[model samples]
Target chain A: MSREAADGRAGTTVGPGPGTGTGQGTGTRGRTAVAPARARHLRTRLGLIVLGSLLVAVVGTVVLVDQLFGRAQRASLVDLLERDLQRVQALVAAGTLGADFVEQGAGGVRLQFVSNAGVVLLAPDATDPIPLAPTPVRSVTGERAELVGSAAWLLPSGLEIGTIRMALDVTEADADRATLRLSLLFAGGLLALVAGALAWVLVSGALRPLADLARQAVAVDPARPRLARYRGPEDEVAELARALNVALEAIAERQQAERDALAEVAHELAAPLTVVAGELRQLASAHPDDPRVRAAREAADELLHTSQDLLTLARGELDRAPDLSVVDLAAVARGVVDAYPGVTFATDGADGRVFAQPDRLRQVARNLVRNAVQAAGAERVRVAVEGGAEVRLRVEDDGPGMTPEALARVFDRYVSGRAGGVGVGLTVARRIVASFDGRIEARSEPGRGTVFEVTLPGWSSQVEGESAEA
Target chain B: MLVVEDDARLRGLVREALEATGHRVTAVGTGGDALLRAVDGGIDLVLLDLNLPDVDGIEVARRLHADGEVPIVMLTARGDVASRVEGLYAGAADYVTKPFELQELLARVHVRLRERGAGEGAIERAGLRLQTDVRTLWAGDAQVTLPEREAELLRLLLTHPGRVFSREDLEARLYGDDLPDSNTVEVFVYQLRRRIRALGVADPIRTVRGKGYTVL
Candidate 1:
């Protein structure tokens, strides 16, 4: 069931999630990731920067071209108007120029001779004089606007004759500039769009190697140590791959050392225990009637039991977070209490459901029941499960309860106040409960007996199917 | 009995205990020596520790299994389920976690050796249990002490209950390369018949006509 839930969480899609460009394995394996997600923000940020730069380049080019076109148009119009005016001024001073010169145009330069007082001297129907200006104005001969340049008609002398004005039709130049700007705008937009799309594609592919690294990391078994495979270029992703492999190795070596240390402790513990057990049995056989030898044998057995519990505590396998599951605490308690003869089990208010490691929970239940029956000399004990926001387990024993001083150190390691009690059981139980993020407490009176209660954070039974989806 | 363990203390204790039980024990402290001894071919049962210094204990068990029909009992302190399962999977007949009572290990060894039914000093089958050291036979609740020749003849028949041992073949094993006379095997077989009747187990040994005898 846990494997199914993990598979469900780390769905078919691996690698970084789309659009997010995060190397968090999509919704994949992120929930159980050992190391932090790599390449999470770089891809999206780089793509955005590339696309933004392309867009800015496109817009800047359009505005610059528009300004240059405007400058070129003015220069060309001024050159055309001035050259035609020179012709008209020379002809008029030579006393051979006529208004019919406008009909003989050069490059659509319509020559109009206007008086220095700013009137159209050749227009017989004209009544209003135009303002004196060397700029484009109203056109003639099938056009609306023209480049009109006006000057005073002067001969060989520097005397100003009637002001001569020349006009050039600019309708075609304006139309051509419009066409160029329109195409530039269209092509620039297309280039920006393609560049942005290409950047997004390239960056999304950049994190593929990271996804492969994540997959390899997921498959690593701590029982066996190995390095992750990497054959990519020496870039940022390669750096990340190297870091990840080093991290895996460091963790593997630490765990291996811990296991070796634990095994060493077991061997060290087993040697003396083995000697005691062997010697105790040898003595018991020689003096079958001696009660001291029998007591020594019992002590040897308790020593073995304590050694086992010590090893369990030292290994700390149950302390790791990934082992937790949705456990039925009531069910675990029932399985434990069924073995002890005088214990009565009941579900008082609710079926206790908690999210914890099932193996550790079973150990906790066993320790409590053993402590009550054996340590307190309780012939009959009542085990109950009550549930609210927290699922609480209560074990009540009708034995000679402890005094306040004894109760103060009950959970301490090797602090047994009663005979036939191996003092490590309560300590192991307390550590196991604490690992589940729970609380354990006891209440007792000298004659009234004792009540030991454990409270674990409850998992709502209604959300059973939700975890399967996750 | 063959005891193979790496730890000096454990190896010593196991060797001393098995020898104290009236069994000849050959003990070694390494897998290399164990495989060599298994090849020597007098071992009945092997108490192999899984945590060896040179070769993996599982690999040793596999090699020993390939060597012959000797049963291997895993004796180690690694109590995790995976190790237990792996040990059993590697052709081990039984596994006893360490910090164990020496008596329990002895009891388990006794059972394995009995099932193999080739241990020289102790043999039990068909309601007849022979303690070779004492040369005594017990059938149901009754006991009968046997003479040397009768004990040797009874042990051979009880080792293989259904198979018939001829008179000549019995003489060869009982006298051990000494040429005993022809009626020498018959005199012991005749003495073994009276002891079977005294033990009160019916069909203890059958005398096939023209053949020798067998325990049924």
Candidate 2:
């Protein structure tokens, strides 16, 4: 049966039901869901940084432009008012200055004349005379007329005419300056908006290759051990990919070396073991009735068993998935029970077929049954199978159970509770079950019996249907 | 027989064990040497070790298989299923893991040789002798001429004495793809036992409850 069918059957069997909730629900646990990746994560970060810098630059330029324009406009307006005063003085020296002349000569410029003797010499049409405290020529020569709200100047007639004052309105220039400020503010805001968007687009475009590289890295399968070469240009992103590829290559090589070492060790161990076992058997045959020889043979068998268990435990550390197939769990349990003849094992259930590697599952069954037999001492060990969407195989033994502390670490490697126990059997069993996406749990109390329940995905009609569809 | 094993002590033990069983043995330490010895011919069986110091044992087995129908049995320290499958697919007739029972190994060797038609011409066990050449059974002073199928069945049982053979196993062996009725094996066993009893010999064929039969 297909794995999916087995999983579906298991899911249905473990579904909620009365009396099924023992406070430890397998349904709510052990399912790992991978969250989806946010596609624009890198782009958002890069865009934010680019937009922030563009805004600062746009605002700074606008403020600097406004200040420079205001200063230059003020200085030029003052210079124009000073030039108007000179034209009015020239007209008076020609003896052609009058009310009519003053009004026509000032063309859109507000002009006024006042005498140093407090007498008004000329004024614009229907306009009052300008109020001025005429400064001495000595003080006036060093200081240029300043434009304070409006431009003003003081002048002296040739040794006989009283000093005349000239003034001009700067309202039109001020209005022009205000219009320039408003336009700059509006243009600067608009430019900032466009520039911020442009920066976001440009930054996202530039980071696309990096994002692609990240995706490739995520897609790499460490188990397959292939180089993760970046196909982009030789930039920083490519450099990062190259470095990661080198690390991966190193890891693969190290793993290969470790596998070779393990194989070598296994062979080295097996060769001597074979020789010892063969010689012992031969000796036992020569003197079949000798207790010492029999004991020696048993010791050799124990050594072989321990060695094999150690090898299995080491293999479990490698964490490779087992080759799965449809297996009969009842048959496996029966075989294991049969191996231990004196143990009373009662198996009652339907043919519990599951998707598992038969040999590995057999190992798990053997380990569990052996432990149960050992724990029960001279008592009976009962093995039962409950067939449903999932097959639950239970091994119970009525003997001195473990303490709370010991029970907690029963599956831990090298933590033996009994004398001569290898302590790796349960660890290996747990690893095997987990490889098939199954679970093994234990319950025990001091002076009470211990129970080990192994739950595996069972093969059923629904699984068959799914497999057929596939 | 040719034995290819790198360990000198193991090679010596295997040679001694097989020679003690009355079979001549040619022992080699390397795959190259094994190949050379095998190519010399007159070898009925090969006991090959997978972890040879020189060329791989699998390659040697393949080359030997290419040469002839000589059966090859792998004896190695590698007990994993993958290696066992690889060895079998590479033309090995049987696989025996390291630290195995000497008796089991010998039994496998005997079976392989028998399958190759190089078995003992006559097997004698428990005061009964069945001669393959003459197709006759001798019980002390009495003798009987048996049918060909009965003689073949007795030979198979006597060779692997005390080993149980289920009815299905016997059926597969005797009939191959052309299976008769399910009780055909039972009738044959019944007739063989009655005929042997009439010859003044105690019946050696034992019926295992729920299983099939065995001769101890």
Candidate 3:
């Protein structure tokens, strides 16, 4: 939409211009935008949870069983001590109470007796005046630790004679309990390891679909935005995929609607703009010396550009695939250059046939040539189309170039170098080119003219049914 | 060639493009008409659009391919991957999505016409006659059985004698997505040379460096 506004649709008055605008990431591989790192963390969190629960369970069972076994062993030891004291009492009642019972340490129980006269007698293995203490206390520890019991020795006449004390060694039982606790702890640790490994495998299996879904989601082209229905069981993962697919459908529908509206606007505006521009060109040429006529034409041209850019911005978030075709690059460039008499066009190679969508190709050519003409004096603007293994379209402008800083960000949207420049024109061109399997770049130096080079594979690059493009 | 489409405007465009390329095109606006002309004969390839008024394009494709006499190329508005695969399975030799470029469509039609006999006879070119039914080429008193790939390549270069095909173009047509080593094109050319030489005929294939391969 420059120079009499004639290039908007050129000769076509009511064309729809299929690839009007959608300067978004138009290529097929738009990442799913489902934060990959966050989805990966889910696997780790699930695995840790499973491992933690098994550990808690294994350790609890071991400690509880150890406590119960220890208590039972101590209770049996105390009962054995009491039984030995009863035997001593029977001897005393038979009137055969001799030192032999105490000296023999009968029944393998240590015995001690006091005649109620301060006389202390001890078993052979017992120390003198065995310290009075409760039996089977948990803190008890010695080479000969015992469960000790004591009772009063009475005669048949019902008179208390002496006190008898009996003790049984608990060293063997304590050793057995120690061994049991050691084994229980070892088994508990082993069980926990095994269970943890099992949990890891189970979690990985259950969440396999999540990883698959993540990959599939990333591969999904946001333009079409469809995900395959999960064929597995209808579990949480399936539900999540369904939810994402639903959101994708909504996004696709909204995009389709916006594109439809903008396309309608483009179609509606293109016809009138073409007719108006066509008439203004005639009027300006007829009255070449009339400043008023020239001014009116420029204003109309600027208005067309503004409206077109506005329509493009409105459809900025949507991406539509273009209609594929074998285009003549030289022909398209020649048409754009013809609009400006000052710009020179040149061709190289025999044929300039390249596979692309024609409407988009025209739009990009117009943007590049227009930008070049505006930068340099129209006389210094040169456009060339080279045909080969790859088709090349180069537009060069010998204007006061840009700073290295400006050159680096030239393609960035909103980077304007001059007044009345819609900075996004170049960015839009790049997206359109990329959507058709082409590349575009700009090279410039401080004092040198800027060269915009676009490389698209020649149509001859494809032979027959061998093209892998979808 | 037969152009079958429900949309009148699109049908007109396809017919005009094919005719401009000098193919005898019979343009129709429904599946029923496409079937009648196809069975009646003289049609080499059918350009069938999937959305038709009378019947499903796939069903029409099956009936057309039932006798295995004619090959079909589908023009579908469904650009999704599954539909393309489904169309191929239904016996279409190839497909071009809707909103397609006219030039690309012409190129595809050109290739399909060469691969299958565009008319009902042996193709005669470069002092060699290729019998598609027997998959063999007769050169003077000698005959050599052409492998499938060689036959496809030979037919393409033979049909478009003046057109130049770059190595990249040859590779794409021969291998689709399965690109082999870098020397694949050279190897295939060498093999074609031997086959022609063994038949006691001068090689017709010539290489245009930095451009492509062409047959004179």
Candidate 4:
């Protein structure tokens, strides 16, 4: 509407200019008109209902007063005029038709008495130059004749006399009508303001609890949110809060149950695993000369070690994650390489370090190395680190890389290529990485080798010096 | 030798293993038999189970030690450190957990016998010889190295001086707790008799009758 107004205004002045009216002024006004119109449209539905009702009440009051006062004032004036007519009739009957007598008999009214010949018989205080006309008389219809509310009478001698004309003064009544209109308008406006203030108080009071609940929900941490039930009402808003609280509690309980089960199972398995490993190690030592026995014993030992790794992973998932220390990635890599020499392990980026639990990182390296060795020939594994704000550790093998489907599912629990395992190694590794807010990704093509990239944040100031100790 | 175990299968297996190594082997399923033989006065060695049906193995071991200087090697379920420590503290000479290799048990048995031999003497046999008070032994003067358990057996034989000691007599000397069944002491003696022969000497410890033994 503003745009249209501006365009209409400009069209008259500019005589069809190229861009002056159409672009800048019209665009600004066009946008400006939208906000207030939207505001007004909203207001009319609510604001106007209250304002219009108040206005109707005020106007109705004025109209009612006018009808009542106007009628009452007119009746009073007619009564006074009737009295004047009666007094003039008596005076005429008595033959006191003198002007001085008429002046003394009429009270404050400008009265005139005329004969049937249309000549004024008596006049009192008639200052105006225009002569007063007798009230119109009809010989046949003689009930009452009034010209502007005057009465005329026919005397006994057939001379029509006692024609009285009086006027009502309404200066005070006019002033009172004006005062009534002003007061009604003032009272209506005051009522509207009070209604607006009342509406504001009611709306805000109604929404205060909801606003508090909304603030709490916004501040709720997604990872560890604890929503409490609203116990105040069985009403709709309270019911919504109650339902949300129930859902949050269910989620928290399930997560806690999973953690507890994982911890309990891991603890149960550890003792048995330790015993089995000890037995196997002893058997191998006893029959050092028997290669077949040694091989069997070594296989059993590996299975035991794998079980330990699974336990470690389960424990880490249950918030038993160890406090981290800064560890030299190069040193840990070299240690794993030395321990398992059959695998030709090489490390790059010896200068790089990372802040992590040393034992856990060792487990991660061992798990990745074990997986790589299983897929590729153990001799072709390589570990590389790239330094930055985050340290990236890459373990790659020349083994057949996985299909995209396998890569996607690799981190899922109980997924493995290794024969006769719980198949939890990769899953555990991923969980450990996630605990540190790090990420592990596997890239592979069918014929090419697989590469696992793990990136973790570098050391904070406290962990900086710990790399040397590790 | 005396075998003390609650399980019948394990008792039979232990008796067979020890008997195959060539001693009169006696096996009992309770600590009561061990206590009986311990009072009878001539058992040579006790292979006691730390987990017993009749008495607490450690308590039985302590009682047997109170009765006499009987060498006891405790056999238990393996790697149960608490029980093993308890057994040792209760006067058992050695503690070994179960599923143990027979060879490890035999090695412990031999060490206990040598320690006993160095402690006492005056025992002689076709495979073992003892000189009492000097606490030394000569198996044909080649100086056989016997572990404490075997030496203790020869020493007991020498103390009786060729009186043809019965399995019960040897059991009483070795296990001071309740005796194993009469055959348990026979098994350790057979093993002792064979290893002594391997050292080229007459076995010093002899089996007599239900009456007992004396060195002639």
Superior by TM-score: candidate 2 or candidate 4: 2
Segments of candidate 2 deviating more than 4 angstroms: A1-58, A92-259, A274-299, A312-326, A338-348, A355-357, A369-384, A394-427, A430-455, A459-470, B1-47, B53-55, B67-75, B78-89, B92-216
Clashing pairs in model 3, backbone N/Cα/C closer than 3 A: A324-B101, A325-B101, A466-B176, B166-B212
Each prediction's DockQ? 0.11, 0.13, 0.05, 0.01
User: How many clashes (backbone N, Cα, C below 3 Å) per candidate?
Assistant: 1, 0, 4, 79
Task: Report the Cα lDDT for candidate 2.
Answer: 0.67
| CA-RMSD of model 2 | 15.6
Greater-lDDT candidate between 1 and 2:
1
Tell me the whole-model lDDT of each prediction, alpha carbons only: 0.69, 0.67, 0.67, 0.58
Ranking by DockQ: 2, 1, 3, 4
RMSD of each: 17.8, 15.6, 11.1, 26.3
User: Comparing 3 and 4 by lDDT, which wins?
Assistant: 3
Candidate 3, position A419, lDDT: 97
Give the CAPRI rating of model 1. Answer: incorrect
Best by DockQ: 2
Worst 10 residues of 3 chain B by lDDT: B77-86
For candidate 1, the TM-score is 0.53
iRMSD of all candidate structures: 21.1, 12.6, 10.7, 24.6
A270-329 per-residue lDDT for model 1 (tens digits): 867887888788888899999999889867866775666766544444332222345789
What is the Å distance of residue A94 in model 1 from its true position? 5.0
Index of the highest-lDDT prediction: 1
